[model samples]
Target: MCGTHGDHGRTVPPAGEGLRIVVVGKGGVGKSTLSALLARQLSRRGLGVVAVDADEQRNLAATLGVDLATVESIVPVSEDADYVEEKTGARPGGGASGMLRLNPDTSDLVDRLSVPAPDGVRLVVMGGVLRSGGGCLCPETALIAAAVAGMRLHDDDVVVMDTHAGVEHFGRALARGFDTAIVVVEPTFNAVQVGVESARMAAELGIDTLHLAINRSRSAADVERVLAYVDRLGGFQFCSTTVLPFDEVVLTCEPEVGTLMDGSPLADATVGLADGVLAGNRRPAGSVT
Candidate 1:
């Protein structure tokens, strides 16, 4: 059954209030992988989790071993083109307007497109929005935004969104739906730049809760450097400074869509990070000690 919405339009589960955690960062920084790991860890703890893949690339579901066939079968929220036109007031072939017009029955489409993971984890893959002549909001984008809002209202145990690397997803109405935002960055100049831009966008969007996750590190020193950069950027704090070791196992296991919780080194780090983030502890590395 479809969940109900709150006064604020966020989805909230009937049993317990869920956390909306979003993973954002530059490309090739393992943001998607970290998102999958976080979902696996939370599910292992017996919490109901829904992982939303807002990226057009559509890799989050695949990483968790969810088949495309199953994903394409979930029912979406809505399918009324006229309703979309009324809500967004987008033109038929305008840029954002045209995009918003595509797939008017978004809720129904997403419900049909969602795939289920092994341990009761749900995967919603939102394809990219194509810009036409007008600046119409993409229907997929609108659907995700509405879904996030609906999830917040229902209080679904945990809503984890794996966003695209470029911060493009953060610009539209969807950015308003997230409660907490986590930026993933590697130890590189370009990655840092992306992180900075992401942070700026998060702040601009009035996101009250924000955190940084440092992925793919070789040593403790690398972790520290990433932390230092985050500090220098100012405004953002480190929720969990987890160092994901460069593991060839991740690549080898990709074909199987194995999760980090499969007893791998990366999985351990991811789990630890998820625990700290969920607990609302934003201390620097070793401060808990």
Candidate 2:
């Protein structure tokens, strides 16, 4: 069912076209915040940006103040549930009759998973039956990856993906679709370790454009220290680390803090990060020197 070859050649993303930036790291490293910040910054610039929540945790929608009931509630693609009838030639909600039908076309499946988001950016929630068994390593993961890649072919302003921590979703095919992989880390042993591991995995998967974003940094010195650690590991492309101050505003914002667009410090840092991404100054893995 897989292995349909398309034009896979690398083309320079057109001017003003939305960039696909994937935020990845261990949980609690503020990946969703970073994603929200990116979306807010880009949108403020009048660019239509979509924030994709590939993580099953479903925090991206909440962070942006979007209430999503189910995966289908967001994704526009045809789901396996939608196929229960077509494959069986049964009506919707028909149990036994739908059980004996053939699966729907892969193209049709991709079409149904695309859900629209507010603003100009679209949101595709990758949470469904596929993520239930193991994770993004399954066939469902491959389908979503294809759909995302297809979306990137359009001239959208930006597509920022908030991935699950620990790089569990860094499947070989999925990683290839991302223009840049921004690994968010805190100034701690575990976060740093995860950053190092994520960089290595991304490189191994042939995701050449890997960069680092240091989150929750108390000071500039702290950001530098984390960069030094990543350099020592020799696997990450270190961009200018964004020093997100430990702000009470971010704390109080809780799960519904979509105010990163309000010219806050966190918003400023995210804008800088987005600028760096758009400029293609993303540091190469192991480019800390």
Candidate 3:
């Protein structure tokens, strides 16, 4: 069942077709893992899924059961200098010194840049943000934001974006237009703090539906500790919460979500989370707005 409170009376629309989600969190909190699993789960239900890897780690393709050779060959939008210039009219190396298109037409980016994955899911990689001392990556960022905003989805399509770790992506508003954000965290102080910050930022971006995904929970006590920390932080609210158990199979597997057996703990919990995401009654909470 969804860990949702019914105190808030008004309900947001259920996540039927065209549901968009962004999975975010601190490093090593399993954001990519959750995103891949959720996409596959929805795909299994006969929904068209587009998995976006906006993370610097570049792990979504492999996690979605894409072959290693294709994963390695992917050229992220941020790193593809030629494509960047063609779309944005400014080279990434040129930085902000030259004039660039603030809003480029990225209508075909999703279809043109995406690679096919298992179960008919398409994968798009946004590449990494600029490194330290590198001049501004404004054009690159704009391209990504525009591309996300322009992705054409059919009635049965869903987008699952795996964002980079930490709060930097929020500053750029790369996740703008996403309907829901699933903040993943482990039962640790720093991780919980990051989750709180991420949740706050997601609300700021106008993403109203939020879910807290507690990964690698050893016991009920661990899950409770995380909830207590979120209460203490006190600025955001989660419409639903999911607790994924600590399973060694997650570690032994080849980092592929499909490799996890059907009845396994993580896989089962992820399917349940997908169900909650699709049908849960989402009510606006006092704190998040």
Candidate 4:
């Protein structure tokens, strides 16, 4: 579907238009905030958004304006023993040595599992992986991974996945088939380091289109510091870089992104970021020097 900005503002492609994005970054760098902003902004533009919380923290739903009661009541796919067993032929917590279907049929899980959230977005929570006796949570991982893979079947839905803080999710191949990856970072060394690593992994996963968001940036110097760090870390190319200013309200607003006004600096910047993603600009990943 063609998107156009008419009198009613920007109109986006309907559900099933198939734009998949994964937002990754270090912990406490506003990854969930960016994900929530993008999901709400895109949904406002007239598309069906499936916001997936692949993080153990499951902060996306709350940030996206889902009520606290609902957020607490919802169970992540990894923690749903019955659903996991039905889909993958193995139950989690059943000892890490059992056989599980590595490639389960999860093409319909997205539709069957997602719950409704505000702004016309559907929320899918994939709980954290559990550690047991040095064994892998292959069943839980496979279930979540396959469910993400299943999103490909929906020709009209746009997916915005909020991954856990760090690069471990990329190791699970959960980022496969995503068209873009947004690596959010603060102006700190540790955050930039994780952002660079994530960008590298996304590129290696064949997600060529990448964007960088410097959250809670205090000034141009903060932006420059992040860019400098990226250059120092061997230069990962991001087609666009957005700086989300440090907002006192955002810091105190808890997790609900809906509290930000339309003209808020942070919210406005996220709108631009969302527009950039929909524009689908392509440039080879190179040094951001």
Candidate 5:
């Protein structure tokens, strides 16, 4: 199935479209917000969308309007001591600083553990690894890395990962499978710097699809200002750029209050973004296999 996008908008996203979309940037740059919005758009379009809350804060659940009880029930697969041990044959040692099985079977883990979400979305909370080293080779990290690198999704399914602040998480193989990456940024020097670094690193990782979305832009001028900043950051192929105006209504976001729904402005904007995202997607769904 080609990702049909005519006047009627996107049809079912192609099955096995190898799309692992990671949303990242500096802290407070709206990574979770963008991930949630993208997931909302994909789900609204009647496509299979998996929203992965990889960030330590676990913020995507709330943004995607998941109930508090469901959100609270999610625990990162890496944190499940018994499961981790069973799969990797390595017991937890305070942090993720133990032996590991490099190629653990993760085929059934995601489906079995993912939290059922609103619409057709599913949520996976891949919590952080408390490794003692900068780049620790531990069981938990290995499991996540193995799961991301080996797992396959249904055709047309899109994986939207909400990453921890900054590009530190990018070093892990779990995030490298993402063919498309969206780096959220605000109109600030620090945010733009992070965006540049994020884009640069993604390019280095051989990820061809890199987009920069400016969050909280007040107007078109502000968007331009952010664009100028990206240009100044000096060299990288940015596939697309979008500006999401600040919505005062979203300031009161609560787990129970709901977001990215029909009445929400954020949802409307993300709908447009979803079109562009699928358009830039060059690979087929589930092509990773």
Candidate 6:
């Protein structure tokens, strides 16, 4: 069931279609894992899915199970001097201040730059700009923001953004036009606080369908306990606070070796969370503005 409340005007696309989603939360809260699995699930259903790795870690490709050979040479678009320069005109490397295409036409870059991923999912890597020195933030961030927000996905296409941790990096460009944001949180107070703050920042950036997922959840009681905290926040009730159990399979598997190793409860829970996130996007026929 969707843990949704309030008047979000978002509407779910018909069968064979998907909306945008940005998975974010505290570090080690499983955002990358969820992003990869969710994209894979959508693609397995024959949907067009794009997995955007906007985190500084740039490890999302590995989690999505992209060929290790491909990961070894992967460079984030934000740091790709040629591609970033071709599209934005502001080059990478040396400090790129001055004027920039804050609203560039980045329509074709998504397909051109993304690499072929498993399950028919395409991957786009975008590293963080905040840590790029405040002076270096403008040009890199402008191009990245335009690409993330301006790319128009097909009816059955889903774009999943695995964003950097915390609220410091939630800018308007990346959050715009996305249908939902699932903030993954562990069963702890500090993590929940980060989720709440992220949700708040995402809302301010115009993303309305905010939700939570309990990563590495231990039991039904633990899941419910987290739900209680989400409820106390009032405005930020999760769309469906799905639980990803702490399974041994995930713990033991080497990330570089494989993803979703055979069968994983965490993977199963992620698939359900994807469905719930989509369910929350559906508005009554007449409710959409």
How well does each candidate superpose onto the true structure, as a TM-score? Answer: 0.76, 0.75, 0.87, 0.87, 0.86, 0.86
Task: Write down the lDDT that model 6 would get.
Answer: 0.72
Candidate 3 per-residue lDDT, tens place, 199-256, comes to: 8777777766677788999998888788788877874567767888888888878668
Please report, in order, the local distance difference test score of every candidate based on alpha carbons: 0.62, 0.61, 0.76, 0.77, 0.70, 0.72
lDDT of 5 by residue, 1-289 (tens): 1122222123444456546788879999778777877887787777778888777777788778787777777777778888778878786543445556768888777687788777778887877672211376677776777766555777677888888888787675655567678878888878989988987777667665666677887777777677677668774455556667788777776442245466676666666567767877333321210
Pick the winner on lDDT between candidates 1 and 6: 6
- Give the RMSD in angstroms, all C-alphas superposed, for model 4: 5.7
Model 2 ranges off by over 4 Å: 1-12, 15-18, 67-80, 83-119, 128-139, 282-289
Please write out the lDDT profile of model 2 over residues 40-65, one tens digit for every residue. 66776777676777777777776775
Residue range 69-88, candidate 1, lDDT tens digits: 86556333223344444544
> How well is each residue in 209-228 modelled by candidate 6, as lDDT tens digits?
77677888887777766666
Which order, best to worst by lDDT? 4, 3, 6, 5, 1, 2
Q: Largest TM-score belongs to which candidate?
A: 3
Clashes of 1: 50
Q: What is the C-alpha RMSD of each candidate to the true structure, in Å?
A: 6.5, 6.4, 4.5, 5.7, 6.1, 4.8
Alpha-carbon shift of residue 52 in model 1 (angstroms): 0.7
Worst 10-residue lDDT window, candidate 6: 280-289
Candidate scoring better on TM-score of 2 and 4: 4
Better of 4 and 6 by lDDT: 4
